[model samples]
Target: MMHAVVVFETLWGNTEQLAREVAAGLGLESTDVVDAVSAPAMLEDDVDLLVVGGPTHAFSMSTDKTREAAQQQGAENIPRRGIREWIASLASPGRDIRVATFDTRVTSPRLPGSAAKKAMKRLVALGFRPAAKPHTFGVHGYSGPVADGELERARRWGEELAATR
Candidate 1:
């Protein structure tokens, strides 16, 4: 079985729930789901895959300013640091480690950018290999219960990611 770690940042819990579902699909016995703020700066030697995700904000990944704005909009448990900051802190793994990324965005008024795409590029720059293309999961609104069926899609995506390894 492949060992995987899923790191994520969530403003209103939609992304976090998706992260958990992804981990479950990857096989809970061998996967760990962690909030970005608490995620490790470097992967363990035995880890085969790293999955990262967060909510899309202002067309891409969340920043401190955006997180603060979310808090003002009644979002609770906003992370002190978001995916961008956490990714900035990552240490190069020094060997090939597969990675996949995902993001949650509003379902309406199709967005122009993706946090997942941006994150995938950064991780690749840091020496992690892409296991698959970046993916986006939809939510009903800014603060949403995720769009119907997205959770299952995320799970299937996770399974597909595992198969790629």
Candidate 2:
């Protein structure tokens, strides 16, 4: 059986919500969601793909403050984590896993593409082959309802990844 894991850092639950949508599209019978902060290193075991995401803050991945703001808004912080911390905790053996990245951001109607360059770089350093290009979902300001169609886009991305796997 193929195994996949979706890990993310979210603020105001927008990215987290997107993560769930991606997972649903993957349609895996066995899957797990872990907070980027407190997730264990062992979660990397034997996974076929790893889906990682975070809110885009200052044109980069979400920081510790991002998670904090989300929690401050009443979303429970599941161990208060960040990608840096998560990277520090990863076990060495799973470096061969495939990976794709996603981020939540405000779609600057004027800008050409979503700001996800850093996300792609991080995944490459972690040894994940992109199952698909890194994607970005739009948010309104700091928190988000998610711009129209972002969720659908995420679902499609998920399906495509699963098909390739």
Highest TM-score, which number?
Answer: 1
lDDT of 1 by residue, 64-124 (tens): 8888998999998889888999999999989989999999999998888999999999999
Write down the lDDT of every candidate, Cα atoms only.
Answer: 0.92, 0.72
* Model 2 ranges with Cα > 4 A deviation: 65-79, 108-116
Question: How accurate locally is residue 41 in candidate 1, as Cα lDDT from 0 to 100?
Answer: 89
Local accuracy of candidate 2 as per-residue lDDT tens digits, 1-165: 778888888757788889999988888887677768656776546688888888766556555675576567675643465665676567644457777888787765433433356766765775667677788788776666888888888888888888995
For candidate 1, the TM-score is 0.97
lDDT of 2 at 3: 89
> TM-scores for all candidates?
0.97, 0.81
